[model samples]
Target: MVRTAVVNRVQDLWVSLAGVGTGFPTGGVRVVVAPESRLCPPCWAGIVVLGDSGIATAPDAATAGFLRESLTGRPLRSAVEAERWSGERGVVDVLGPASLAYLDESEFRPATSDAGIARLPTGHPALARLVADVSEDDVGESGIDEITSAVFVVRDGAGVAAAAGYRRWPRSVAHLCVLTSARLRGRGLARAVASAAVADALRSQLLPQWRARPEPSRRLARQLGFRELGDQVSIRIAAHQVDSNGDRGQPGGRRP
Candidate 1:
């Protein structure tokens, strides 16, 4: 369970991400709040409130209804349990059940000198080349452009050995992402670059947010002084559109 203060901060962050004047629904499920025409991710709409209580919101009333029906009666003790319940329903795709970690300035520790490391501009050609060399699809061109902070890269004769950076989320949160070349899998380059990025974020007074799915990523977060804030689960409904009458308008399909 997350602390009440952290939960409040998370809610504020969500509201900020959703844009000005957007607020959490009073109770039950309501339409998902997003910035302008941008669609919020399905999991982003479902939040774990007050510990075990899971609230699912959507952009439309129909989707809200679907989410409400899916999560209303369940006791979700953790993000993993929420994911399992969402999976069995067969109408949504579950992501996470992963750790939501963060680091404060006092806890951050920068890596020691490493000659192979360098700070790269967001969307730098070398960074792109590195990502390509590593065959990483998680962070794309758009993702690089979205990052409002520094990008750190480590290179070897082969190419980019590792890369790390953070994208600006609402409420001064820096969402960290890291990737390492397959050839350098066991090396400490990932940790080195990630530490550089974290140090930079702390200098800017931005709380570094690490949502780690992979075990290595989680370990790295802890190594960099990020504490486990909580767990999160996100669900994506199969139906692309909802009708005006709060209905899915078609037989729903399921995704894993």
Candidate 2:
């Protein structure tokens, strides 16, 4: 039941991002004409086009102008090409690559409630420790502020074994984030906590979005029933403008 609702929500978000009057561009390039603010807050400035072929425009005018020129005669064919072009043109310093994906709530299997997994209220004391276990830069993007509605944690004798939760995003999307302590690696704790968070997201009628740097993270998303929708590159105007959050932005031109 939740699956159907999530699918509909995903469609609505795509429509909004694509702009009100425009339809999908021909030849597999789906252009999002709306401003970045109207789309995702983390995205600063640039054209974020996603579809069979995904491309992120450079944020700065000069690099953005160059990207427009490159795309005038040819459409971006693949993420690899996008990365290659940026590197060759020295635009990699300004643009970061990322994978876009959404959970297939239809395929999601509810994990049996585990006694070890505990759902905590926002601002719980334990949350501070869990956040500390992960990268400090991610605290903001984790959405653990006053508006956070749900937080799930798995605790071991040492401390937080893993944690997961979602932040509200535009279009009723749940921006999911997860973290597992280094010592607990390979224990499936990440998946366990993530499952709890996803279940909560569905119960609240929110769609789960799993956008991250492609790789092990993608593998984890797949394990939790997310499928790749497309890819995008993000324009970074300054080192600080780019998010250091694990799920949002990667610094130093790291592919996310």
- Using TM-score as the measure, the top candidate is 1
The global C-alpha lDDT for each of the candidates, from Candidate 1 onward, is: 0.61, 0.58
- Which pairs of residues have clashing backbones in candidate 2? 98-256, 213-256
What is the C-alpha lDDT profile of model 2 across 57-86, one tens digit per residue?
232334334445445556555432446545
- Candidate 2 residue runs with Cα over 4 Å from true position: 1-23, 28-49, 53-64, 73-75, 79-82, 88-95, 137-147, 237-256
TM-score of 2: 0.71
lDDT of 1 at 231: 60
TM-score of each model, paired residue for residue = 0.74, 0.71
Off by over 4 Å in 1: 1-8, 18-39, 42-45, 48-55, 78-86, 90-92, 114-116, 138-146, 238-256
Residue-wise C-alpha lDDT for candidate 1, range 110-212, written one tens digit per residue? 6776567788777777665666655435554214446667678886664567888888777888888887776677878878988888888878877788876
RMSD of 1: 5.2
The CA lDDT at 81 in model 2 is: 44
